[model samples]
Target: MTAPPDRRIAAHRPDLADRRLEGLVAAGQFVEGERWRIALASVPLRAAPRPDLPFETEALRGEVVRVFEETIEGWAWGQIETDGYVGYFSADALGPLAPEPTHRVIVPRTFLYPAPDLRRPPREALSLGATLALGEAVETRGTLYRMTADGAAAVVDRHVAPLDAPHADDWVAVAEGFLGAPYLWGGRTSLGLDCSALVQLSLAACGIAAPRDSDLQESAVGRPAEGPPRRGDLVFWPGHVGLVAADETLLHASGFQMQVVREPLAGAIARIGAPRSIRRL
Candidate 1:
């Protein structure tokens, strides 16, 4: 038998084992009433898995938040309080993280199955965590979300948690509603999604059609404008992108330093970031 190729976050960070103090960092508020947190140790995914697409990494010694709904074990996207670099992690093998409302974390284990009706008794199968929203939303009916090893994923009767980030949830809702997920690289489903795909999908939810990918996103979304950005605007970086951060910052799951992050518009503009754009959709 052939051995599976080593596709791990360490591939992105060859120096992940080293415990080092890099610099002063802090988490930014996405929602208006969000509480902030100061990371002590690295809170990486127990395993490495893709959130939207394959990830790339660089050398670093710090922590990361594994997006279970988006990635696999042994894989994680590296993240600092500031930069969200793309990388991997050993799922369920990192320090403990305080899963709070302000900070939405996916369950590392889940399951999915094709069921005709959610009201029907669930099959004698358990799905581990894989996909995570603020909480899973109930689908129309007779839909299989997916499966892992613990819980089952179904669009049926699931309920969404009280999301503090209304805008964020709204983005998710609008995106999922349009896409109806589980979409592949080009697959459009309310269950699956990608980064740019999410953007385009969200816009579509709001009745705005956009082309796929970053370059296309700039052209299809809102037009070029000079000045501080506001809510519902899309922020773009070179080969990367994110949503506006409350008129002053930009929030995104940047592949640069993987993980959902926020940064100031000026700070983003001054850097090697791309032409920041906005989408009124």
Candidate 2:
């Protein structure tokens, strides 16, 4: 009989596989792009492009003002603030930040950097998100700095808003994608990557500005003022470096190993024989 046709044929599933990014993707975009993120609740922008760079790093942050095509790449768009300097950026870089009347605060809280991986610490660290005694904290490049309760200066890689108001699980999800990137001297993109570049760019994509080198990255920010060890921070040995993990673990593009590898933080420190320092930034 013609009962329910033949059930053996596969129907075409286009939405999941046929999706096209709305802009020009870089050579690595198909594999390396971070998807489904939105900028934090605040940042300044304009309705028309100003005489400036359109995307932070070196330009002004722009809203998704308009989208067009260049016939060479893919979708071409412009971001204009209240002022007018139009610049071009790819559409794939666009997240879901609201494209509406822009807002500027007198005491501006967050500032995005060229490096995309920086972020604010999670809210558990802040004592009451509202109605708390707020004090002045400074930012370098795009990371935040704070003075200790006992009058000491400290810099922290953000894990909170402005950098991002990330939910708890987001950090771990992003870290997984960085596993096999090749080691680079000062490279930060997907091709030949280095330890600090991995940390910096990963955090930068989250709207965090991590310093570029191992020595600078390891200098500040983490749980202990000084450490036996800590995770999600950088570990340093004389002329060598790696990132720390929860299990007294470390990740680095080691010269001896000659590639990105993970090892015990204690073992790495012992092998290096008295590390010069550890930076939490």
Candidate 3:
């Protein structure tokens, strides 16, 4: 029988091992090129080049990726630089490589305005952690404007932070802000985020490196916390995780609640079952 259609395509790009391509590359018959940058707000990285298929991850705007192949149907097979994730992305979501980012959005989402005028419509909305090239800063009528990549500009309020800003000391506060955000299986942005994505993004904002999925996160980050759970600790189940808000509380993006929420740890354990492990970072 034929092998099942490869679901691991998004995790491991086996297509890179095509016999013909491998032969050509081994014989020094391939070309090299620079990586491309994502231009759209966010693009899904799917196992295959189809919208109906499931997506494994998302490439945020301004993220760079190295393309391995481009199909006639307008999809590009590539590796995302931020997380080394491999999958197929829409070619239309990319642009020529640009300079490194100078700033990162701090708010859940903010609008990119075409001009400084408030009455004018926005060019687009940028999600938290979305990076952009910096340009001149201008202030008009008591409002400050910061020019962004592609000549777009956003009001330079407290919504955006310098790329080099210090890591947050209280990560719990950061995760708590998404208390009402909708749940999306593969989403990482504030627009819609899943449990693991919420944990990853919140920790990332605090300058902690995190993997995309819960199991990898449980393996890669932090050390085990001894005794009773403490604030800033992490709790893990089979495929899920929650952040400790206090000795008896957990803060997490719950698929069951369909949003982020704070709950009593014992109650969560009863509903989601006992945790496999607890850790501290």
lDDT of 1 by residue, 176-239 (tens): 2322223233222223334565575455334455655666677657776556566767777656
After superposition, the stretches of candidate 2 with alpha carbons farther than 4 Å from their true spots are: 1-176, 219-227
lDDT score for candidate 3 against the true structure = 0.78
What TM-score against the true fold does each predicted structure earn?
A: 0.36, 0.37, 0.87
- The TM-score that candidate 2 achieves is 0.37
Better of 2 and 3 by TM-score: 3
Name the top lDDT candidate. 3
Best by TM-score: 3
lDDT to native, each model: 0.38, 0.39, 0.78
lDDT tens digits, residues 74-100, model 3?
A: 998777777667788899988877577
- Backbone clashes for every candidate come to 63, 37, 0
Q: What would the per-residue lDDT of candidate 2 be over residues 1-281, giving only the tens digit for each residue?
A: 33321111111111211013213221222221122211222122222234243222111232233322222553322322221222344444344433321221111123322222245333211110111112246666775654222222232434222312442333323443555656655433344456655565445444444544455555533433365566555556654656666687777666556556677777777777776666654
